[model samples]
Target: MITLSETSLDVQQAIQTATRLKAGAVNVFVGTVRDNAKGKAVLRLEYEAYEPMAIAEIKKIVEAAAAKWPLQGWAISHRVGVLQPGEAAVVVAVSTPHRADSFAACEYIIDTLKETVPIWKKEVLEDGEEWISAHP
Candidate 1:
């Protein structure tokens, strides 16, 4: 499953979607809005995306990871609009037959999503705001 939502992310929902009876391991990664970036105090984060493109890119990442790993299922949820600190920005969950595969696939999905998805973020700071690149 892949979704770009304007509402707050539901991490448990992602986990549930990825979990299956045959899977022995489930891995989840949740990214949250941080309070600070580059020593500046972040007031909030505003995320915007070309929704259709972002969803397609996320689906591609999931498919590639599944082909590389023994994955049973996976789900990715990315939140848009303004979010406060500690709110979830994204959640990625993957289930596999083994812990190693689950971890690897989950990591691959998040990394690839950051690199390839057409999602943008603006860091609203105490002093100013700036739009930053999606990837690290």
Candidate 2:
């Protein structure tokens, strides 16, 4: 499963989606908004994305991870729009026949998604807002 949602992220659903009977491990990664960044106090965060391109890039990442691991199932959900501190920004889950593979693939997916996806993040601080990476 892969999705870009404007509502709150469903973390348990992500984990359940990646659960497999043949799996020895199910690894999950959740990224949340923090209360601060650098020396500024963060009030909230707003995310935007090039929707079509972002989904396509995620598909490519999922394909690459599958090619590199013996994955049984996987799920990824990313939230868009304004989010408060401690709110989940992203969820990644993967099931594999072994613990090492599950961990590796889950990490790879999140890291690669961060680097390659077309999602952008803006930090709303007490002073003002600034775009973080302008790319995800």
Candidate 3:
């Protein structure tokens, strides 16, 4: 499953989607908006994306991960629009027959998604705001 949500991301929903009877491990990664960045106090984050393109890129990442491992299920939920500190910006969950596979697949999904997905973020700071690279 893949989602681009303007509202808060549902972490548990992502986990549930990836849970399977054949899976022994379900690894989850939740990325949250931080309170600070590079010596600046972060107030919030505003995310923008070409939704169709972003989703397509994320699907490609998932397919690549499945080719690398034996996966039971996988789900990715990314939040777009304004987000406050401590709010979940993204959720990635993957289920596999073993703990290691789940861990590796989950990591790959998040890392690759951040690097390749067409999601842009503006870091809103106490003093100013700036657009940052997705890979950064």
Candidate 4:
């Protein structure tokens, strides 16, 4: 599954989707807004993306992960636009015949998404807002 929405993600739902495939292992990743980044107080965050490119890139990551791992199921979802502190920004889940594959594939998806996805974040601070790379 792949989706872009402003609504909150349901991890149970994601896991359910994965488990329905008779997977022996399931791995999940959830990224949330932190109150601070590099010691800078983060009042909130605003995310914007080149939607077409972002979605395409996300699909590519999912495909690569699936191909590289013996995955039985995969799902990735991301929330866009304004997000308050502590809200989830992204969720990824993977299920496979073995636990190791599930963990490795899930990590690959999230790390690659941060490195390759064309998503940008703006930190809203008490002083001002500044755009930053989605990855550290």
Candidate 5:
């Protein structure tokens, strides 16, 4: 499953999806908005995406990871709009019959998403704001 939503992501839902495959191992990675980036103090973050493109890119990452790994299940959820520090920005879950495959695929999913997804972020600081490229 893949999702781009403004609502909070449900970890349990992701877990359940993986569980359905009767996987022996499941790995989940949750990315949260941080209070600091570099020396800047972050008040919040706003995510905006060219929706159709972003979703297509995310789907491609999922497809590639699944094809390269022995994945029993995989899921990714990315949050949009305003987010406070410590709030989840994204989650990627992967399950497999073995621990190694699960871990490796989960890591690959997150890494690929960061590198290829078309989601852009605006850092909202106490004094100002700046837009950042998703991969940089």
Candidate 6:
């Protein structure tokens, strides 16, 4: 499953969606807002995206990862709009028959998503705001 939401991201739901009985391991990655960036104090973050394109690109990443790894199921969700520090921005979960495969596939999905997805984020700091490629 893949989705781009304007509300809070539910990590538990993502995990449930990716879990499977046949899988021996399940990996999850949750990305959140931080209080600081590059020695500056961060207030919050605002995210925007070309939703259709972003979702399509995320699906492509999931498909490619599944082909490369022995994956049982996968789920990815990204949150949009304004978010404060420590709030989840995205979640990626994957299940596989082995621990190694699950870990590798989950990492691959997130790395590829950052590079390929059409999501934009603004870093709101005490000094000013800057539009960035994406948040970590």
Model 1 poorest ten-residue lDDT run: 54-63
Of candidates 4 and 2, the better by TM-score: 2
Per-residue lDDT tens digits for candidate 6, residues 22-136, read: 9999999999999999899999999999999998898889889978998898999998899999999999999999999999999999999988899989999999999987443
State each model's CA lDDT, in order: 0.92, 0.95, 0.93, 0.85, 0.86, 0.92
Tens digits of per-residue lDDT for model 4, 6-109: 78878777777776356789999999989887777889888887789988998899889878998898788888889888898988988999999999999999
Candidate 5: pairs in clash: none
Question: What clash pairs does model 2 have?
Answer: none
- How are the candidates ranked when ordered by lDDT, highest leading? 2, 3, 6, 1, 5, 4
- Alpha-carbon RMSD of each model: 0.9, 1.5, 0.8, 1.5, 1.4, 1.5
Candidate 4 residue-wise lDDT at 75: 81
Residue 22, model 4: Cα distance from true site in angstroms: 3.0
Model 1 per-residue lDDT tens digits across residues 1-136: 8988989888998999999999999999999999999998999999999998888888788779978998898889999999999999999999999999999999999988888899999999999999988765
Clashes of 5: 0
Cα-lDDT of candidate 2: 0.95
Tens digits of per-residue lDDT, candidate 3, 103-122, equal 99999999998898999999
The predicted structure with the larger TM-score, 5 or 6, is 6
TM-score of each: 0.97, 0.96, 0.97, 0.91, 0.92, 0.96
Among the numbered candidates, top lDDT falls to: 2
Any runs in candidate 4 off by more than 4 Å, and if so which? none
What is the alpha-carbon lDDT of model 5 when measured against the actual structure? 0.86
Candidate closer to the true structure by TM-score (higher is better), 2 or 3: 3
Model 2 C-alpha lDDT per residue in residues 47-94, reported as the tens digit of each score: 999999999999999999999999999999999999999999999999
- The collision pairs in model 3 are none
Off by over 4 Å in 6: none
